[model samples]
Target: MEKNELGMTHKKKEFSEWYPELLIRSEFIDYSLVSGAIVFRPSAYFAWEIIKDYVDKEFKKIGIENVYFPLFIPESLLLKEAEHFEGFSPEVAWVTHAGKSELSERLAVRPTSETIMYYSYAKWIRSWRDLPLRYNQWNNVVRWEFKNPTPFIRTREFLWNEGHSVFASEQEARAERDQILGIYLKALRELTCLYGIVGKKTDYEKFAGAVESYSIELVMPDGWCVQGPDFHYDGQNFSKAFDIKFINKESKEEYAYQNTYAISTRVLGVMVATHSDDKGLVLPPKLAQKQVVIVPIPARSEDIDKKLQDYSEKVLNTLKEHGLRAFIDNRDNYTPGYKFNEWELKGVPFRLEIGKKELESNTVVIAIRDTSEKKGVSLDKLIEAIDNEIEAMHNRLYENSKRMVQSFIHNIESYDELKKNIANGGIYHAPWCGSTDCEIKIKQETGAKITNIPLDQSDLHGRCIYCNKEARYMANFARSY
Candidate 1:
């Protein structure tokens, strides 16, 4: 079957099935030999590279250095922190044997590098000079998840950049936490024009060892929520547990404050789900590998073909001169329709069509993948026209997704409305009394989980939505991916 004609399930019709199938059929990822792992294809990995480059440059600008930590953590070290160990123990993958020998103490595959990194920091940090050590690592980490693996969303192993930092003062650590989250927000905006709601996760949803946690939640096309750019203020929890102490300039010893921020490859998943449509992927211009693809419609005569070929090259070179990624699609075999489908499916942001008439008129036909809008542009205005299309496409996507998110969020004051909204696949925001029993009761009645508690805010509503008692916090609840 033709790539576009394949009997694929429509994403809106059956999002659960279509999401995975799109990942496979689009050649973004493939099932690995290992049951729960996936092989990331060039298209997906290229998007990841774009994200990595953007995030890495931001980190460097802020004086954070990249470093590598071991993939395996000793069992003792992994279990050093009581709450953290308990939290991750179920999902921790263990390395029990080595070279046909049974190890005395099985090592745990690094679900996260917190326990191991903090353990090392204890010894390396001796004075206040080493107090604010910031390190980030880009690598794959494993957690033996029992659920089915969804390529970028949930998997036994996935690639991510984890930022770990230690500071002598809580104020410094808090500032670092917020700064990194802001960087993530900026990177998302720069790359995908995606905006996220910034808030703090509730006690039940916070990280394993964090004292307080903040998150940026992105609303997906399906009305589900994906947590992005999580920042955890450790408040000397790990530092104290692991004895990560340093001598202050005042000759006093104190525990170091820790902060960590992480944005996973999962954000790529969010990008694909949010922007892509029934046709195929709809990539943001900044992240697309081929921003503009030049296709020359074949002419009957060899002389015409030669002119078209030369014209296509000229257009490609002009785009390159203007700092846009451009390529000439000069395959002699494939039809123009096929080329269009392939490029659209691949999510090229812009397509420049050079033909006999266009070459004679000193114009090129521009087709944008995001909106499927086509227009003829003079060669003189080609660069400016292309840039304008990209900006408009990004704005179109941002606004569309923003509208979807705003519509999905329902502020419910009544219990029945909360249940009905959540059952109908809406993210519900309601005031709560801040009791664990109330939170659990809501979960038991509705399948939705409390996602975030808006941070640094005063009281919004007068009374609790659920219990009629005085409200403690305004909690945002949603069914997450």
Candidate 2:
């Protein structure tokens, strides 16, 4: 079947099926020959570039430098951090032999960079002057999972930036963790048009061996709550494990405080699931490679052909002049409706249609993808209209999803309520006494685990929804992806 013929007829009707289909049709990713891996096509690659460029700049603003680490870890090194190794052992892919010759020690393909990256950090730090060593690496990690891989969301191999840093004191490390998360919050808003909940994960859900882990969670259209980007604070746990220490001003040695964070291609999955609709992807202007698509409507009258082409080029040039990612579809074989469908499925933010009627009226008709609104735009005000409409659409997407994030959250006041509503999907906010047993009970019975405790809810409390004990904090719960 031709690409346009498929036309995304089932998107809103069946989103789970729609998302993967849109991803494949839109040329974002495809299943690879290797199990649990995907080939990132241009659409996915370019979007990652925009994200990488933005966050790289933001990281530099806070003194985080970029670095690269080896992709293989020695067996001895991987065993250094006991808790981390134990947590990751099942998923680690070990290289037992070097093709023809068997190696003396096994090397595990990097599941996460902590073991290898920190091995280097131990060598570089000597004194208090080298206290805070902030570095970030853009690379791929392999977690060989047994579950069914879903492209960007759950692939065995995926691209991500793992940021690692060291600090002199626990206070300094904790502050850096939050500072890094703040940078992520800004980037997420500008890049994805996402508004997410800020919180710290429960002890059971926190990062392996980290003192505390924090997250910015987003609710998708399918009612799943996923952690987007996050920061982790390691209070000497790793430094002690890896023996990373520095001399203090008093000439005594103390373990260095450390942290690590990640923002992966998984965000792409969340963005598509959050903002997209029936037609296809609804990319924010900032994330799109080509934000404006100009389709020259075919002229029925023979004399008006040149006028349509000429005016279309003029409008396209003006958009480019204003620094927009704009392209004009001057294909001779396709109809205007076909061009519209093509760009709509690709999620171009705005479509400018120029036809004989629009030329005669000295105006252009634009289709806003976010709202599916079409309006006639005056020729004199074309530039301003395009800029305004693009911004308006981003704002509209943000506001709509922002409301959905709040509205979908079900506040449960009792255990029965948790059991009844959890399977239906949505963020469940419930009061909880700080107890792992209660959390386990909820998960075993209802299949919802502790996602996070919002920073705002730390002080607010009541009776535990399950045990009726004094509540420690209100927490967010959901069946994660």
Candidate 3:
């Protein structure tokens, strides 16, 4: 086979070159006519649809209703929240012209729906009876980021579920954080088969206009940290700005407390980068569109070829009946060897081979994707065997990701140690005194910034790694994506 035809030309260690090749060559996604945007292929979109469906079902169970907002936000509405507008100003794309004429008011493309969504929230929320309004929108947003885009990872436009919830009290709003974060964690574990660190963002790193922000952070193969799903507590900052006031239970008017959270398509990129290999993409069973592919070996005789085809069909049917996504690749143009390589590159979790021997024995040779272990399974017990293999593969992928992240973490006691090792890649667990100056100075001296102060603050004891002051929290610092 030619080098390009075989799969990725660059190995996983050559990440910068290899990642795009893996994504494009594997037919996962393609570059769009617009710069910094991508067109999701069938497999990539299928994975995202699975993720969306799972999250949407979870949200619906918790009383979060789905709704859609206008894609354009007027500049006046965006400027209602000064801090929020300022924070997003640089990247906010605007629509100032309609045909040949310039519009009277500039409309900012939806960098986020907070400004536009809350406008209606202010109007709709008028009485205590409308105390808690939980709404979520699964939509796309444009940020027009200047940095080089890496498909879903750093795209100028991306899809996500923006969850905006309003409550009559701060206590009620605050309580939603854990429930929502728990849902994201479960989705990452069950759907993506990935692990992440959940933590609180520092004041300097918190969302603009939010009282506090919390995120699920994942470490990339290159040792860079990427912010995953995040929840923000907008403690009446947006409510006051947009006049989202409601009558209290005590018969008094009060500003509504709010929260916003999201899980974007970016996690798909993270999953692809973390689990895939030099040969091609390595997808978890749940994320894979076709979990099993049955490729029948040609016998070069009409009678034997017919038998092999029949056996391959039988195997495919058995897997499908048990709720597995299975397909038969009996293309006459491609050799069995080519079919195996194609399916392997596409990251099908299991590949079943049916040949003369297997046909005679009423069995099929099953090949595992992550591990190249092949075993023969009788057709009668095929479903049971596949179920077990899927479970094992899922667990294996999650554990591998967890171990890789754990291995990259370095607990540093001094600033010098951090500077010397920050470039090598990995999360630096260090003590911080909770000062923005110390955070800034550390970031300036070393390119690493605080990823998050972990929710687990049980072992914080040492002095600040930079200022040498009494420690406030144990923060994970890393150069991020």
Q: Which stretches of candidate 2 lie over 4 Å from their true place?
A: 1-4
Q: Candidate 2 or 3, higher lDDT?
A: 3
| Each prediction's TM-score versus the true structure | 0.96, 0.96, 0.99
Model 3 misplaced regions, further than 4 Å: 1-4
As for candidate 3, its clashing pairs are none
lDDT head-to-head 1 vs 2, winner: 2
Considering TM-score, which of the candidate structures 2 and 3 is the better prediction for this target?
Answer: 3
Question: Candidate 2 — what's its lDDT?
Answer: 0.85
Each model's lDDT comes to 0.84, 0.85, 0.92
For model 1, residues 210-237, the per-residue Cα lDDT tens digits are 9989998887777778888799998988
- Give candidate 1 regions above 4 Å deviation: 1-11, 456-459
In model 2, what is the error at residue 175, expressed in angstroms?
1.0
Q: Write the per-residue lDDT of candidate 3 for residues 1-481, one digit (tens) a residue.
A: 6545677789999998989999988899999899999999999999999999999999999999999999999999999999998889999999999999999999999999999999999889999799799999999999999988888889999999999999989999999999999999999999898999999999998898999999999988999999999999999899999999998879899999999999999999999999999889999999899999988888899999998887787777777788899999978988888888888888999999888899888988899999989999998988889999999999999999999999999998999889899888899999899999999998888989899999999999899998899999999999988
Model 2 Cα lDDT, one tens digit per residue, 154-207? 889989889998999888888886777887887777778778899999989998
- What is the C-alpha RMSD, rounded to one decimal, of candidate 2? 1.6
